[model samples]
Target: MSPIPTGRLFRTGTGSDLVLSRTFRASAEDVWASLTETERTARWFGPWEGDAAPGRTVRVQMAFEEGTPWCDLRIEACDPPRRLALSMIDESGAWHLELLLAEADGSTELRLVQHLTTEDGLGETGSGWEYYLDLLVASREGGPRPDFDDYHPAMKAYFEELPARAETPGHVR
Candidate 1:
């Protein structure tokens, strides 16, 4: 069975945001470590090295991507254990992403928003984030990582239709 796509696209005056969230039964500080600390991140997304502060640039290894490419990512903003914003430009184009963390009742919710100038390749982009985020979850829980094949083509159609579905009356945003 295919994994269900959980990302939602919200339109804005300038463009749109592709948002996906994951809930963890861990403290915000712990989740923040999984996102920020290089050693922890290496297990899920990839390891990053540099000064790592707002306005600083870091070299990150896309450990899961083809060829395991390296890219320079700039830290747009960082509010420890709460919010982080980053931007990078590569052969694929520019990527602007933000993560917001909220904690309540001993659980933390990590909300990821990708600011997009256009909805051109959401099918591919959306599935990619889903796979990475799930990898984060699996890393934390000591579970098996998700297969990309179970995400990409399987969930592509759902993401491709989100813009149209969001336009329909009574559609939940």
Candidate 2:
């Protein structure tokens, strides 16, 4: 099956925001653990260690990536069972990301948003988030983790086309 690129790009104060969301038939607390707790996150994204707070930094390993590259993530905000915002800087540049959770009728919706400063790397960056989010779904629901290869080239066009669509008035796709 092809990877689904269902993210929406919206104009934000900084630049643009790429938002991807998934609704799970699980409690917000459970979903929150998966997102914040190190052991649970290792199943989907990667493992992280360090004191986590609004102004603290944590070292996270990109377990799925080759060489298991590690990066320092600065916690920007933390609202338990609701929202968590973090930032990181690497060779590419600075990245600001947020994870928001809302629960209704025993189901939780997780929204992962990346605040973009430029649209240059949307294709690669968006696809990576899609793949990782799907990995989160699989880890929770019990299934094989998705392969990055399946997401990149296949979902590239869909993400690359988002910026232009966001600019056009009345365009909804």
Candidate 3:
């Protein structure tokens, strides 16, 4: 199967939405709590911290084999289980992840509205989010999870070629 995140890249508005929504057969409580709970977030997303309760700093030291997604981000927003936002210091405000959570069928429909303010190198950002979100889905459902932040050597190849794996041609967004 394809690695993930294989779609045409399009330019968007200043707040153009680059959203990725998925329904997990998991608990809203588990998914929401993990957004800001350091240990939980670390398992599926990176630049981890031991805690995320507001005011305290959460470090996300992300480096992905010079391919997939590469960045070192600092904790920007931590609302825990209900909302969570984080950004790269270098590209602060340029790219952000707004985690919105809602309850459904005794499960959680975690909506990750990842907004990339600009088109410059955002494919990498989206790809990384795509990969990590996969892990989130797996974890939220008690499925197997890949290394969310390790960024092993082969990851770069997957990131570089992700678009090619799409079932449909690139569409304008």
Candidate 4:
């Protein structure tokens, strides 16, 4: 079965944010490692190199992507185990992203927000994130990795329709 797209779009002063979240039965600190630590990240997203500090730039290998491109990401904010904000520019465009973590009742929830300049191509963008985040989950669980084909075209329509649905009355974000 195709993965269901769970991202929601919210307008912001700058532009808009496409938000998605996942929950894990792990501490925030553990989840933080999965996001920041090079070895842990390599299991899912990709490994990053260079000193990581607020206002500093780091090179991250897009290990799963074709050609395994490397991109420079500047860290904007870092509040250990709680919040992290970053920005990067590549051929695709400029991307501002934030990851917020909250833990309660022994489970941690990771919320990812991509600050988008325009809503164009949300289908492709949102699907990409869904695939990556699921990869994180699978890596952590040592389960089978998800196929990108299951997410992209399969989820394209759902994400493409999100903006219009958000405008409807009585819509619950």
> TM-score for all predictions?
0.95, 0.94, 0.62, 0.95
Candidate 3's error at 103, in angstroms?
0.9
Ranking by lDDT: 4, 1, 2, 3
RMSD of 2: 2.9
Give the CA lDDT, 0 to 100, for residue 74 in model 3. 48
Model 3, range 69-93, lDDT digits (tens) per residue? 5455445666556677765555434
**Candidate 2, 1-173: lDDT as tens digits:** 77778788988655888889999999999999999999999999899999888999999999988899999999999999899999999988889999999899989999998888998888888898999999999999899889899998888989999988774223211
Model 2, residue 164: C-alpha shift (Å): 1.0
Query: Which pairs clash (backbone N, Cα, C closer than 3 Å) in model 2?
Result: none
Kindly list the per-residue Cα lDDT of model 4 for residues 1-173, writing each as its tens digit. Answer: 66788898877666678889999999999999999999999999899999999999999999999999999999999999999999999999999999999999999999998988899999999999999999999999999999999998999999998888653223112
- Write down the lDDT that model 4 would get: 0.91
On the 0 to 100 scale, the lDDT of residue 139 in model 4 is 95
User: Which residue pairs overlap in candidate 4's backbone?
Assistant: none
- Scored by lDDT, the top model is 4
Computed on alpha carbons, the lDDT of every model, listed in order, comes to 0.90, 0.89, 0.56, 0.91
RMSD of 1: 2.6
Model 4, runs deviating above 4 Å = 167-173
For candidate 1, what is the TM-score?
0.95
**Distance from true position, residue 132, model 1, in Å?**
0.3
Pairs that clash in candidate 3: 32-81, 33-81, 47-59, 47-60, 47-61, 67-156
| Clash totals, every prediction | 0, 0, 6, 0
